[model samples]
Target: MNSTSFDLDPSYHILVTGGAGFIGSNLCEFLLNNGNSVTCLDNFATGKRENIAPLSSNSRFSLIEGDIRDLDTCQQACKDVDYVLHQAALGSVPRSINDPITSNDVNVSGFLNMLVAARDAKVKRFVYAASSSTYGDSKNMPKIEDIIGKPLSPYAITKYVNELYADIFNNTYGLETVGLRYFNVFGRKQDPNGAYAAVIPKFVLQLMEHTSPVINGDGSFSRDFTYIDNVIQMNIKAIVTDNKEAVNTVYNVAFGERTDLNQLVALLKEFLSEFDAKIADVNAKYGPTRQGDVPHSLASIDKAKKLLGYDPQFDIQKGLKQAVRWYWENLK
Candidate 1:
């Protein structure tokens, strides 16, 4: 059940590293709603103020405005925390291509700092956000965790390095870890105004403004468009699962289906047209494929289903409707 509530003991303290970003903010809110003590570490680099503004009033929630690149900051945030849900990172392939050094520093070195901090603190488990981009250059239909190709971008390499580092810490230091290789996760609060904005939210914003959304390649490129609630479910289960086999391993977190850019844009128009009929006329433009883009992506998610009891409740249709309504009510 993706009801935003879990029946676990709420006395534990959890830390969400990218606490003010879109996905991270959702996790923080969900964790706090379930009565866990949460410490949010964010540098406000890519994270937003409005995302976490509502959660600031909760007394049990703590905020640390610092960078993960600093070991001291990592140590400070890990203090007395029982579990660490590490989500902080520089998250765009194009941006990484432009500045790979920064990406490596934040994603690789910063990840190392978090792992060290979690290890030192002796947290029960360390759950971090991994990416499906790590499956670069692979032509697999439903990506399995064990099968991957050479990384196609600097961002992808950094994420792959995260899995490597997690494994090392687990094997070398007895640190318990779980990695959820998220597909194209989207939902409310996913910012639509950045050079590296995700396709769905960016298209929603464009259609709402009567501007054309651009497809990087042909309309055929597809993705395993996952919903935020499902992702939150995966994260929570990863944190609380009693299955020993689930620890120190990675799992695909997705809806087990794919949607092409054409279908995605059409659906956006159909839904937004309900609010403003004129949006139905707004079309999407085609452009050259992105440098590190893949033609198609769909995750098996069988491992997560078998291990964490993950049953995603939102497919693209259902999740898109909810997200469109949210944009109309809150941000439009």
Candidate 2:
């Protein structure tokens, strides 16, 4: 989880929207550890309180129980903030398919609200969590920043809309922005309880509970499974960079490698079985391919490397091993 390759000023006052969630909380902790002042804004929709409970005692850490859907709350949270890591949004393609209205209200409209607030507050940079799903319907083996296809799902539509709005905000208002189109990010503090839980953590938890985890689409679908540490590194890089070319553009945050669901299941089982031998016997069940899911997703991180000096520290096997250990110690 070390990003010793880069550093930021200790006196910076940063705000992280959805700071109680998985990626956001990790960012908050990393910033706080590096002696920065941080204000966390979360509505508790998907963010868990337990994630931030440990940081409550830190003198530089402040919490604002708020939502990005509300402009005033966003404005208040943005006040005096040097940088804004905007991670507030309703995620999950299936959830968006089930309730596109709420997803739109949060991912798109809420994003607009945050942009306006950051603009008015004059935050130095607004780095937001974009999605790899924006590359939907493209047959590109390795997703590039410039080339993209039509969005396939409501969730993808919302994330693509966020990028559009961010671009407009930057061009129209002169606000600085960086959008990180995150691949399948997973790691510690990631919730494995919900119906929309990510594959890695979900499968780990199911195996720990001695239940067979189901793999969708015969376990052939692949994704660029990035670790949360790499995502944190990108966010830090996004905000701290003095390179003018890096600003107001999007970069894919990933390890630049793809892992299929079958390989993913095998890795999860292999790591989790170290704690309990019974997990080794639990076979995976095959299910239908999910809607709005692309067959394979791999990222061409060349843009990230060229612009931001983005270097990912962990690969899939290393990330999955660390994540499995965290689940066994904390949740299991």
Candidate 3:
């Protein structure tokens, strides 16, 4: 992935809380490549060690095997860190519904612990992985950051609570914070296995295996399907920006356009067919819509563009092509 030219100094020490997971691992790799000292903290609950294995060779990259649910572990991870990118949260609405208590314990309570630790450590900035699910139940076509509706699931509730706590920390404790509300982010390193695997990776794997991928709804349901590179740019921008007005706010990180599920599958098949034409023949099966899933999700990235100078390089087509190539080379 190409690096964005941000103002982050190479000498800064950074901590990535879920640095073994898909997005977190990618962030750690980017920071380390830019000549920064990176500390990764992960308990390996949902994160896989193999994702971050290559990073071990970098002398500036260190791993702290711990959980955020433990306040002491969070404190240790924040020690001597200049910035904290908090990405250690239990994702997936279905998983949250199945186990709300565990989800709360990790996403909500653990997030609070990280906030407390960062506040006490006096980190220069706290940038976290907030979700688009916080826009729940609202019928707005292009979701703006300020307006939100009732949360549809346990996962949404936890993410929304994160925003509230971040706000409180900034107001009451004076800790700098920025929340990036990411839309359906996908790219390389994202796991394609397990019940909660995201649709992009899961479908790519099924098609490569010559199996029909299932669509949760009539296939018209759409999303803003952001690429991982765009998300990385936002995180880096969040940490390095010197504009005081941008520090305490949440911004939407997305491609600024929507793509429906049917269109998404067609694009995937087209991209994968370059390697094996048989992938085009594999069809998608229809199923009942998932509970708590919104019919459509689109983000207005005007805030991020104006405040943080975010210029997303990859649209869905560009991102999907790269993602398909990675899965073809890695999975096959």
Candidate 4:
């Protein structure tokens, strides 16, 4: 919620890897605004310099142009840092399917590098960006942390591996770790132009241009679309929580609700229509279901609420309104 609500000290030095990406950049901004010394490490592979350009001017913000795949760079970034928010990873199942090697190189190997570096540096805590894709083929509704099905994609495997590694590091090396398995997160600065671009921004951009956005399935597929601020809240909670039981564990970082693709498109159009009524007429085209895609996903946030006191402030409609307005002003 607010800076005063967090347990983080103003003088603490924090390292946010992938700090130029959408979520990481947002985290950096939030932390720096709260009077924390924030260092950003990014390779610019999928991260954008424009995201952190404004933050660079802040006296409390520093940037390290490096890759997480390199242990030396990870160590350098972790140096003197009080906390490590490891958000760097190759996202998207299709992208990982196309290039599993590269994805493994970054998501798996790179993650290990960060863990080792954090262990060596003895950072106060290691908070990382896990994925909801870790649920894989589970038919379970309102997915729980303790019950997960087998991973279906290379991306999922990599993220699951991250949790396993985090557990080992905490037990063997005495490193405190918390993993937040983020759902489909969306918000400002999310790139709409890319093959692997997320659904919300991409569809918003398409609607803004009065073009048809393609749906991967018949539009029944649902996901717990989390807002960026909610994700930021989870990261803050993970780093600031004093509960011993909360540490060395994973929590589903989501809004704890599901929105089908059909509803998502309708909502986007409804919100975007306020800017340009023509967008309200734009419709989405359906296509065959995507590989490595699950039909529906929901999260049980009881654990986060009970352990970390996580309170997500934005829901789909509210978050979509803000996101649509942001896209209109910035990208339209």
Show the lowest summed lDDT stretch of 10 residues, model 1: 1-10
lDDT of each: 0.93, 0.93, 0.96, 0.94
| Predicted candidate 4 versus true structure: per-residue lDDT over 222-244, tens digit per residue | 99999999999899989888889
TM-score for each candidate, following the candidate numbering? 0.98, 0.99, 0.99, 0.99
TM-score between model 1 and native: 0.98
RMSD of 1: 1.1
lDDT of 2 by residue, 196-315 (tens): 998888888898998989998888889999999999999999989999999989999999999999899888888888999888999999988899998999999999999999989899
**Worst 10-residue stretch by lDDT in candidate 4?**
1-10
Task: Compute the lDDT of residue 306 as modeled in candidate 3.
Answer: 95
TM-score of 2: 0.99
Best by lDDT: 3
In angstroms, how far off is 111's CA in candidate 3? 0.3
Clashes of each: 0, 0, 0, 0
Task: Give candidate 1 misplaced runs (Cα > 4 Å).
Answer: 1-5
Winner by lDDT between candidate 3 and candidate 1: 3
Please list all clashing residue pairs in model 2, or write none if there are none.
Answer: none
